[model samples]
Target: MSHLTLIEQSPDPEESKRDGQRHSIADRLRSMGQVRAGAFLLLGATLAALAWANFAHGSYDGFWDTHLTLSVGDLQLDFTLHALVNDALMAIFFFSVGLEVRREFTIGELTTWSRAVVPVVAALAGLTLPALLFVLVSAGSGYEQAWGIVISTDTAFLVGALALIGPKAPGRLRVFLLALAVVDDIGALSIIAIVYTDNFNPAPLLIAAVGLTAVYFTRYLQSARGLVYGSLAVVVWLAFLASGVHPTLAGVAIALLVPVYRPERREVEHALELARTFRQSPSSEYARAAANSLRESISINERLQSSTAPYIAYVVLPLFALANAGVQLNAEILASAARSQVTWGIIVGLVVGKMVGVFGSTALMRLLRVGEFGPGLTLDRLAGGGALSGIGFTISLFIVALAIDDEAVQNEARVGVLIASIIAFLLGAVIFRISDRLHPSEEIGRTLLRPVDPTRDHIFGPVDAPFTLVEYGDFQCGFCLKATGSVEEVHRELGGRLRYVWRHAPLTRFHPNALAAAEAAEAAGRQGKFFEFERSLFSDQEHQLPSHIIRRAQELGLDIERFERDLRSPAVAARVRDDMLDAEAMDITAVPTFFVNGKRHTGPYDAQSLIRALEQSAQEPQPGSSA
Candidate 1:
C-alpha cells in the first residue's frame, strides 16, 4: 500500500515511517518482529477459533457471549466478551491505526500532493472496484450492504506475507506498500464511520464535537496533558456510543488531535546534555528529568504508538480474531456457504477485485506519467503486492457482525473472507516466485548492491532526492582523492535534485593505509564528521602513518580518546568491511567505482560526465519501476 505513496513508489519507504528513515537497528528489528509476530498471531488465533468452534461449539459461543458490566460512578455499561473486544479493545487498535494515518498525512508519505497523489488515487480505486465487484457477484444475496467488508486491506498481513515471500530488493516495494497501506487505512476508517452508523443522534454528536475540541486544545496544556486527553477521549467515546456512532471512532478523533512531530535536534541535544549530567551525578531527580525530557523530545503520537503497540499486537488483535473468527462449521453451513452469493461475492471482491483495483490504478497512473514506482520495486513485485492486498481479514470479519445480523449469513461471509485471504496469499507468493526469478542480482553487475539507508549511509543531500550518486573509493588512492573536486562540483550544480553517497572500497593491496583510513573515517562518522575527515584525508593523500590519522582528529577537534578507541573497534572495522564486501560482490577491484541512481556509471570521471550521467539516470526508468 505504501508502495503507492512516495508520489513515486507507494511502499513504506514504515515508509509512512517513510519520510525515509529506518531509525536505528533496534527499532527496525523491533518493527519487523512486531509485523511478523502480529501476522502469525492473527493466523494462529484464526485457526484456533476455527478449530475450537468446530470442536466445542457451545463453549466457544458461551465464552464470547458472556456479558460483562462496567460502572463509572452512576453510569452502567454492559457488554458481551465479543462486544468488549470489538468496541472497547478494537478502539485502541483503531486509535493506533489513526496515529499512523495522521503521522503519514503530517510528515509521512502523504505530507505532499506529489508524494500522496498515486496512493490516494490507488487506495480510492482499491476501495471502489472491490465494492463494485461485491455488488456484481452478490446482487441477490441480501447481504449486498456488506460490500464494505472487502473494501479494506489487511496491511499487517500483506507486509508479513511479503517478508515470507522474500522478494529480492524488497526495500522499495515494502516502502511503497507501507505508503499505500497508510492511505488504505484512512479509507477503511472512513468507511467504518460513514457507512455503518445508524439512527444518528445530533445532540450527543454535538457533545462529541465539544469533547473533540477539548482534545484539540489539550495539546497546549503545560501539564496533566495525558490526564486531560484521557478524560476527553472517554467523553468523546461515550458521546459517540450514546449518539449511535461507533465508539471506536473516538480513538481516531483523539489521535488526530494529539500533536506529532520529528524529534527536534536542539531538544535531542538538551536531552543528551541531561543524560551526561545524570551519568556524572547519578541522581534520581536528574534521572527523572532526563527521562521526561527524552520522552518529551519525541512526539506524543509516536510515544502513544510505542506504548500501545505491544498490547495491540499481542492482546487486542488475537482476542479480536478469537472473538470474531469463531464460526461453528457444520455440513449444512458449509453447503449453504458454498451456494451462497454472499460468500462468493466476498471471495471475488477481495481476491480478484483488490488486485485489479490496486495494480490497475498503479499501471494507469504510470501510463499517464502521473507517478512511478521506486527503484527495485518491479511490476512483478507490485502485482504480487496487489494480490496480497486482497487478504482482507480483520475488517471483513468485523463488518460481518455490523452489516449482517444473521449469524448463519455472518458465518458464510467469514468463510468467504478466510478463503479469499488464503487465495490472495497464494497468488502473491506465486507472483513473487516468478517475478523475482526473472530479475536476479547476477543480471545487473552495474547496480548498487544495497539500497540507500538514510540512517546508516553517509549521505550529503536529501535522502528522498530523486537522483542518487554512490561513489565507492579508497581514501588514500591519488585518483580517488582527485575525484573529490568533481563530486563537489556536481553536488553544487544539481543542488537538492541529487544525493551523494560515499562508500569505502579501500584498496589495501595498492595503498597500505587505505583500510585504516577507511576505518578512521568511520570512527570520525561516529562523531558526525565523516565528510570533514574525508576532505582532510584527501588533501594530504600521502599521509601513511597512524600518528597522522590521530593528528587529523586533533586538527578536526574530534574527541581524541573516543576516536582512538573507535579506530580500533570491531564495529568501525565492520562498517568499512561492509562496503568492501559490497564492492567484492559487485566485482569491483578498482580505485573508484560510481553508481548513479543504483546503476554503475562507465567512462569518464569528470564533473560534467557525472552530472550528465545523473541527469540521464533521473530520466531513465529504473528496474522494477513502472515508469
Candidate 2:
C-alpha cells in the first residue's frame, strides 16, 4: 500500500497562504457570530417584554419578582427571579464579553497600537460625554448617582439594527462599533465593581482570591480538564457573591485567565505526523493519541469562546432582556416620566450625547492627523454610527438595577431607555439610508479590466470569443482545485462563445511552491505545451511538488534541460510577478476570484451561476460600445 500524508504539505509559500486564508475565515466567522443571531434574539426578547409588561402587567411583575432560594448544609442563597436572571445569567454574558476583549487584544483588530487607538479613544469619549450630559441634566437631583446608566452601548441591538441595512453596510463601521462597545463593556464592568458594592467582606474576598489563583495555576497543567475549570469558576462566583462584590465580575476574571496560546509549530507538526501514522495503520490506541494531539493544537480559550458564544447570545442575553425590559407603559406614567429629570437625563445622555461624543471625537482625530477613517467611513456614516450607539439597552438596564432602589425612578429610567433607543434607531437608519443614496456602494456588472499582455498570458478557447472568463488562482488553493471541474464544464457548454484566461495569484505567504508551479506552467508555454502542462498540473490535484512538475514536463515531450533553464529564468518569474501585481492593483485578495466579460463576478462561481453570468453579459451591450 502507498503511504499517504494525512494532512497536506506545501512548500513554505503555500503553507503561508493556507494559514492566511484559514485565519482570515476563522476571524470573520468569530466576529459575525458575535453580532448576527444575538441581535435578533435580543430584539425579540425586548419586544416581548414590552408587550408582556403592558398587556399583562400583573403576571409580568408577579413572575419576575417571585423569590427563589438555594440552601446546601450551612450555606444559603436567596434571590428573586429578576435578581437571579440579572446576577447569574448576566455573568455568562460578561464572560463572553471578556473572551472577545482578550481575543481582540491578542489577535483581532485591536492587536496593534494603531488599531487600538481609534476605538479606545472613541469609547472613552463616548462614555465620558454621556455621563457628563446626564450629570449636567440631573446635577442637583438625588438621581445623579445614576450617571452610569448611559455609559454603555447595547452591542447586540446596535449590530442587529445595522443588519437591517443588508450586506452593503460598510464593514468598517461594524468593526469600529464592536471595538467601541467592547471597551464600553470593560469600563461598565469596572464601575460595577467600584461604585456598586454595598459592603466588603474579607473572608469571601480571600476565598475568591485563592480560587482565582487556583485557576491561574491550571495553566501549567498539560491537560485542559473542563471539570476542574468549571468547579473553580463556581467557587470563585460563590466567593464573590459572599464578598459583596458583583459575582458577575468572577466570569470576566475567569475568562481573562483562560489560556489563549495554541501548541507550538513543532507540536502541531508532530500531531500531523501522528495523524498520518494513525491513518496508515488503524488502531484504537493510535486514534486516541491522534485525537488528543489534534485537540491540543487549538487554544482552550478559543474553544471555550466558540462553545459558549451561542448560549450567551441566544439564551442568557435574551433571558436577561426578558427579565429586565419589562416596564409599565401607560398615559399617566408617561406624563409623569416626561416631567422627571431622571427620564430626560437618560434620554439626552444616550441620544444626543452618544452622537456628539463619538462623531466629534472621530472628527477631531481625523483633523489632528492622529488616525484616519476606515475605507467607506464618511462623516455622514460616522454620524449614523454615533446615533446607533444610543441603543443602550442591556448594560443600561443593568446599571439601573444597581444604581436605583426606588421602584418609580427605575421605571422612569427604563422608559427613557426604551424611548431613546427607538428614536436613535430611527435617526441612524435615516442618516445611513441618505448617505448610502448619496455616495452609493460599488455594484457588480461594472466593467473593471486591467490591461492584459497577450504575449505573456495563457488563453484557452477562441481569442475572439464574445464572453471572457478571467480567473485569479493559486495551484495550492483547495477552492481553486474544486473550481476546476466547474470551469471545465462551463468551457465545454459555452463552447466557442466563451474564452478562458488564467492569471497567477500564488498566495506566496501560505503556498511556498505555488510561485514555482506558476513558473513551470510559464516554462511549458515557452514550447507550445502550456495547455497540456496546465491540465496535467491540476489533473492529479494531489502531487504538485517540483519532482512531479519535472515528470509532467518530461511527459509533455519538452527538452528537460531547456525546460529547467526556462523555469529558473528571470523572464518567467517576471511574467508570474506581473500577474500578481495586476491582481493586487485590482484588490483581489483570494484565489478563484473570477471576472466575467471584464466585470467582477460577485455571484457564486458554480457552473450554473457562471453560465448565467456569461449569458447575461452576452445579452447586454458592451460599455462605451454601440448596440
Candidate 3:
C-alpha cells in the first residue's frame, strides 16, 4: 500500500469514528463561545429590555420590583426581582470572570511580570484617568463617590465591537484589548470589595475564610467531587453575604484555588497505551480504563472553563442586561438627565477619558522603552481600540445600582451609560475603518520562512528530504511541548522523505526559563546530542530548572566541563537570539508556529495535518524548478 493508505489504515475504524465525533462536539462548543454569538445575545436582551420598559412602563416596573424571599427555618434572605438578578444571578457571571483571570495569570498573556506589565500599566492608566475625569466633571455635584462607574470595560460589548469591525482588525490587537480588559476587571473587583461594602463583621468573615481554605485543600484530592465543592462554595458565598463583603468575591477565591496543571507525561503515555489496547481488543473493561485515563490527562480548571463559559455568556449576562439595561426614555426623564452633571461626568469619563488614558499611556510606554505594542498593532489601531474600551455598559450599570441611592441620580447615570456607549461605538468604528484603509491585512503576505542553515541549527532526518518542517518554538510553552509528540510521529512516518528543523523562539517575557533552556539545548547540540536533549526537555517538566539540565546532561554522557562552558557561552546565546529575530521579522506571535516548504502553516499541528501538508508539497514542483 501507499504511504497515505498505510497511515489511514493504522487506526481502527470504530475508534477513529468515535474520535471524530468527539472532536466535532468540541468544535461546536467552541463555536458557540465566539464573540459574535455572545454579542448578539447581549444586544437582543438589551433591546427587549428597552422595549418593555418604554412601551409598558408600569408593568415593567412592578414586575422587576417584585420582592423575592428564601428561607431555611429561622434564616431568611429577601431581595427585589432586580436585586436578585444583580446580587444572586450575577455571581455566576463573576465566577466565569474569576476563571478567566486565573487562566490569564497561569498560562495566557499575563503569565509573567514582563508580559503583564504593558496591559496592567495600561489598565491602571485607563482606570485612573477615567475616574479622575469623572471626579473633575462631577466636583461639587454630590456624585463623587460614583467614580467607580467609569473604571470598568465591558468585555462583551468591546469584543462585539471589534467583531463588527471585521477581520481587518489584527489578532494581536484583540489579544491586547483582552488582557487590558481583564486587568481592568480585576481592578474594578478590588474596588468593589474594598470601597463599597456597608459594614464589618468578623465572625462571618472568619467562616468565609475557613470555607475558602477547605476549597483550596480539595485540589490535592485524587478525585474532587463536584457535590463537595458545590456545598463549600455555597458556604463561602453565604458567609461573605452576611459579612458585608460582596458574595461574588467568593467566586474569585474559589477559582484561584482550583488546580491548573495536567497529569505527568508518563501518565499521559500510559493513557495512550490503554487507548491502543482498547482499540485492539474492543472490550468494555478496557474502554472504561482508557476513558478514565483520558479524562485525567486534562486539567479540571480547563474543563470547568470550557463547560461554564457558554452558559455565562449566553444566559447569565443576557439575563443581567434584560433586568438592568431598561432605562425609560420618556421626555421628562430625558430632559432631567440631559441637564444633570452625573450624566455628563459619565459621558466625558468614558468617551474622552478612555481614549486619552489607553492610547496616551501606551504611547508613553513605547517612548519610555518600558513596553511596546505587539506585532501588527499600530498607534492608530491602538487609539481606535482605546475608543472601543469606552463602551462600558454592563459593569457600569452594576456599579451605578450599588453606588447611587437616589433614583434620579441612578436614572441619570443609566442614561449616560447608554448615550456614551453609542457615541463610543461610533467613534471607535470610524477610527477602525480609517485604520483598515491605511494598513490593510498583511499577515499572509509577510509570512515566509527563512532559509535554514545546517551549520547554525539542529536538524533531524535526511538533509535532502523532499519535505521540510521548521518549528519556531519556546521550550517552556505547554503547546510547544505537546507538539513534540506530533513532530516525532511525522518523523517516524515520513522516514527519509522529511527533514525536520528546530529553531529557538523563546518568549523570554512570558517564559523566564526559556532562554536558559534554549542555551542548554544548543550546548547539547555541540556535543552531538541536540535531539536527545530536546526529547529529554519535552518529556519532563523538570528540565526547566538548572539542576535538572545538569542531571540530563550527565545522563546523556556529555563532556561535563564543555557542556557547562557552552551553556554560558556568548555564541550559544547569539544563535538563540538570531532565531528569535527571524521569528519577530515574520511576526510569529505564538509558540509552535510551523513552516512547511517555505510557507507558514496556519492550520492545526496534529500529525495528520502535518502529513497531509507534506504529501501535498511532495506533489508540487520544487522551488525555482521548471518542470
Best by TM-score: 1
Between prediction 1 and prediction 3, which has the larger lDDT?
Answer: 1
Candidate 1, 1-627: lDDT as tens digits: 111111111112123223312222234456467678988998999999999999999999999999999898999999999899999899998899889988877756676576578778878888999999999999987778998999988876887888777475465567667778888888888887888988888799899999999888887887898898888888888898998888888898888888987555346657878999999999999999899899898999999989998898889989999999987678998899999999999999998898999899888887787864544555677789889999999877888888988888899999999999999999999998998688775564477757777877998888778888888888877667667888889989989987888988775544667777888899999999999999999888887456788899999999999987777554665566556655544545354667878887766778998888878777775431111
Tens digit of per-residue lDDT, candidate 2, span 437-486: 77544442144435333554677877777878888788777777777788
What's the lDDT for residue 6 in model 3?
7
Model 2: how far is 551 from its true place, Å?
22
Q: For model 2, where is the 10-residue window of minimal lDDT? A: 1-10
**Cα displacement (Å) at residue 199, model 1:** 2.2
TM-score of each: 0.74, 0.69, 0.72
Q: 234 in model 3: Cα distance from truth in Å?
A: 0.5
The residue pairs found clashing in candidate 3 are none
Clashes of 1: 30
Q: List the global CA lDDT of all models.
A: 0.79, 0.78, 0.78
* Clash count list over all predictions: 30, 12, 0
